[model samples]
Target: MIRLALVSNKLQKIQLKVFDSSTFSILRCWDPHLSSSRSSSQNLHDPTTHFHNEEALNPTELLNAQITSGELNEDKHQKMVVEELEKVHQNLQHYEPAKSTMFTRLFGRRDVMDSPKGIYLYGAVGGGKTMLMDLFYACCKMPRKRRVHFHSFMLDVHTRIHELKKTISRNQTSKPQPFDVIRPIAEDISNQSWLICFDEFQVTDIADAMILKRLFTELFSCGVVVIATSNRHPDDLYKNGLQRSNFVPFIKVLKDHCDVVSLDSGIDYRTRSSVGKDRIYFVKSETEADREMDKIFKMLCSMENDIIRPKTLTIRGRNVTFKKTCGQVIDTTFEELCARPLGASDYLQLSQAFHTIMIRDVPVLSLKLRSETRRFITLIDTLYDNRVRVVISAETPTKELFLSEGHDSGHDDHRMLMDDLNITAGSENASSNIFTGEEEIFAFDRTVSRLTEMQTEDYWKQWDKKR
Candidate 1:
């Protein structure tokens, strides 16, 4: 039992059970039973005999220490926790039971979708969106369901459409045999009562933007209960002239199908003032790009590259491949080539032939636009989908390879970037030797380590493991 304190991101206080170090990168650990009630805690084992016993950390240091320790993801599990805590914080007299409102038509009819009595969590960034969803996920006791990110969720949808296309394409004469777990999963997903929870539910770009209706419409008609945490207001989603109007009917559909609620009651979770020493991701210059490339390559080299089975999968075409593995790849359109569906025979047929993927003409990571920028997203999608831990990149310094829509000279880009770097660096797990005799179920994620540093094209061959 590890009693955790991430003073960063609004000085949060949460508890978690640290099962083991086999797959986790726990930075700070403490036995819940032995935790001191006294606010001042110290590392007595430190060689330096001195300690800063400050009384109550300022918001900045609280945020910094929490940020530097890499615990922001855990923070997402607190929306409901905070709501539960808010009751305690206010010191209320009694518990208010959730009221019934089927007839009111807040979203839909009573007993709709067979009334599975599931949860629906929604909120803004740092507004305790994921926190509530994760808490419910941990506490819920139900058989048959799946939790996934919106990106991976869409990938599964793409894979499904792709596979359905294949299943029909084969035109098999035999009756559907004993239900294969994977075959009926797509159809089964609709029949069962699924408590789907999505984090960071913002729609971006043309690809994902187009399919919003068909995807969720299928899910809703099939009976999937969604609990989502988002940074945008439901109506305000897909902001700007991003062709969101095409998704308007789906927005109405979402509002009609789900119990929409707001959780904007407290402080911004990202605004914790106590975090100490801000960390910044470097933007590389043309002259020093070579040095940056080495830094990124070393990060990948210090990792374990291995195969992993995807938890949620799509059986596309006759191909036996699954579209999602680590389930991080998100796209609005155009399925990644590696994620193309495969049937049993189709998979066997393409084994040695589809071995190596050749991503041609990858661009340098920098402010300048590169031809391969779109391909980078595809590369990331395939790597994440196939669970390919070992990625041979011709591109160097990830930032250079994935060029951002360069600064518009307005809006707090610098500050927002600092916040993004601070948040991502704060959210990741540290790399240790994560490989042993035990078969690895998850990817080693050399991509993140490389992505953390500046990517340079000068040493492209260095990223290849074969050399």
Candidate 2:
């Protein structure tokens, strides 16, 4: 019996040593039994260990370290936001997820522990909201956590809802009810992630707007905490959107669950250091632009041994063809990319396939090209989120790409739709809910901000590292 006990103790020690050497060390630190007895500094000598001490995981500490290292400039606004995020990071360290009991499940009661209030950080374009949020998300040690672009999250939500409805249709044994799938979908998301960080949170689509209230209500009830950064305030979201009255309650829910913070420091940080530093964006005559793009393309292609050829990407059973591709680089035109009917999903596929994209002949956009403008916005958003590099040849400078003065003729189709729905100009909600080019104009500011940032050396370096 003494020999058996000795062997058992030896095996347990070996198992612990293995865990401490691997990435699982972080998780082991969260274990109550292990954490109670172990000092955080005990693993400091081992360089393989991720965090040296509990303070190492603090978002504020990390932010200040970056500032000290000159990787980031000291900004009072950014400092304040990180201080708030530090509180959240500390709270999550001690958070224990409440488990559902059989009695609670049977009675449809959620027995959930109170979670820390999430944050909603809003500011003007080019502010450091995303940068701070990213710092916080990286420092969070929770295993059940997710960081996603808001548009991508909504797309996933819509896809899941569709699949769920299809499954219900195929299941013959289940009795048909009202067919509401939001609660179940929310539960699935909550099970996957207890903390969700969203970048660029906005609501423009009516389909998404209508479901926000129920979805978030269920998520909050399930103790799923949310942290989001946006240009618009919660009340300003879905402004002038169709059936926006129904979406207002979601704003209330969001405000009730989150402490809203404004990070407008009167400084556009992204534009301060990097504008016009990179020579990728060329504003010249068509012929001159073409020559410049061809020269750059050839230079890039020479680095790869693969022959230049046309590439086709199949997304959702649809084929999207690019005329020129060399290995992971694609040379396409603005007309070919934005003139066609493409969306977030299509752009996402392109971003995945290409490390660098060269776009030529991007003309000054007006309301007449509203569809193309919207597509361009989606493409930029997806590419930026994925850290994909973009080179552009445009008719005007980046700041002048989108013209603000144009007749609202592009929204005639919207007006016709409203007329068909018996929502006339005289209707009480027509002024607020009518679709127009103004929303596009408002969104173009963000697109312009991103485009300017894309031209910076730091942005290119980041993309190269990601590639």
Candidate 3:
């Protein structure tokens, strides 16, 4: 049988208890300390207080300012989403969360007031979902607020759950009541932040899919608001996967808690300009591309005063070796970066260690290389979010890197995934839609869009500023 295992051994050591398959129920109990905490607005500096003559603008006004300044093209759909976010921004000014302790939530009457509904913006790639959300997050005056990539956030969640399990296991003196760790974890998060903004929110892994309902149910109950951007709608999340029926309840929870908005303007802003600018992306033959990359690497190394040698990174107690390094730059290949089992944490560490990344020999992605494709997408997302500079040499143009054909239908990766899902060949569940390259096809649009944007003159200007 093909097995789909957890990537981390720490996660594998702790067995997560299966949750009930009924409609998700919110946890009503609250920590007294969190409920009695001071409002974040009191501690933070309001932008309005900075200038006596001008007040802070809401998300709508900020978006209009960008359009008027020619930073962004005007689109009515984007305006609609911004207006909705503005409402939440205005509501939070005078909003008060209901107070509840475990005692009152269980026995006595509890104070209850409605909180503002969060937002989930979904649409096509490069439709300005992230841009608009950033505007909202920037204008939000909440001191206890955090904005992060969704993949990085989930990585942290898994790590926290593993660490929590280890702590609970070491306490030999306490009697174990029916322990559900997600509750305490949610309470801890609520104590830290009242608002969370997530970019590129998605659910693909079974581990993440299973825990979201319980985790979000508790987070929502603690009165933590979320604003997220994604390419998929709530109902379309985790469309098909192993035991997906059990994961369906999260869709309802998300829809009930967040106002779903679509911001598709039918134009991909990232790809409006042509590629091959700034001499960043090389599309020549493999040998020629390698030569060009070497020249660039040496030039970058000459500019830096540090010594040139190999470097090793220690991540999560694991050592990863990169053969080429010169100061704040590293020269690596797609095989070393994406073809192996590296993940978001690994890429996050690499991005932190290096300012400029030179990657050579990126092969044309197909269904046979679905795992590599997924990893590549994650790597680019992490780098792009961090604003790290990337120089790439690929087998084809950036837009044509991922092929749409399905000639490798019976590949081992496809068959293994089907077997792991307990789907037999020729079965209804094993239809073309299940193990096909649909997700990769949809995700490559984003990868290509980001790659195109990374080559723009403006992107290079940002890189220069960082240097």
As for candidate 3, its clashing pairs are none
* Per-residue lDDT of model 2, residues 1-467, tens digit only: 01112335565475455432322232222122333343321110121133345464568777676666556679998899988988788888887556555565457647777988999999998778888887787787778899889999999999999899999888857677676788777777887898999999998788899999999998898888899999999989989887888889999999988999999998876667544333678898534877767766765564455789999999978999999999888999999999998899899989888877999889899777878988998899899988787889999998889997874643768677877877867564575533567678888999988898887645654543343
CA displacement after TM-score superposition, residue 189 of candidate 1 (Å): 1.9
* lDDT tens per residue, model 1, 41-103: 211111011213534332233323434554333343343344443332232122121223434
Q: What's the residue-level lDDT of 403 in candidate 2?
A: 91
Q: How many residue pairs clash in each candidate?
A: 46, 0, 0
What are the TM-scores, per candidate, against the unseen true structure?
A: 0.42, 0.84, 0.82
lDDT winner between 2 and 3, please give it.
2
Off by over 4 Å in 1: 1-113, 116-124, 172-186, 191-193, 205-211, 240-245, 264-467
Candidate with more favorable, higher lDDT: 1 or 3: 3
Candidate 3 wrong stretches, greater than 4 Å: 1-54, 96-112, 174-177, 273-277, 416-421, 425-434, 463-467
Candidate 2 global lDDT: 0.76
* Candidate 3 global lDDT: 0.74
lDDT of 3 at 207: 90
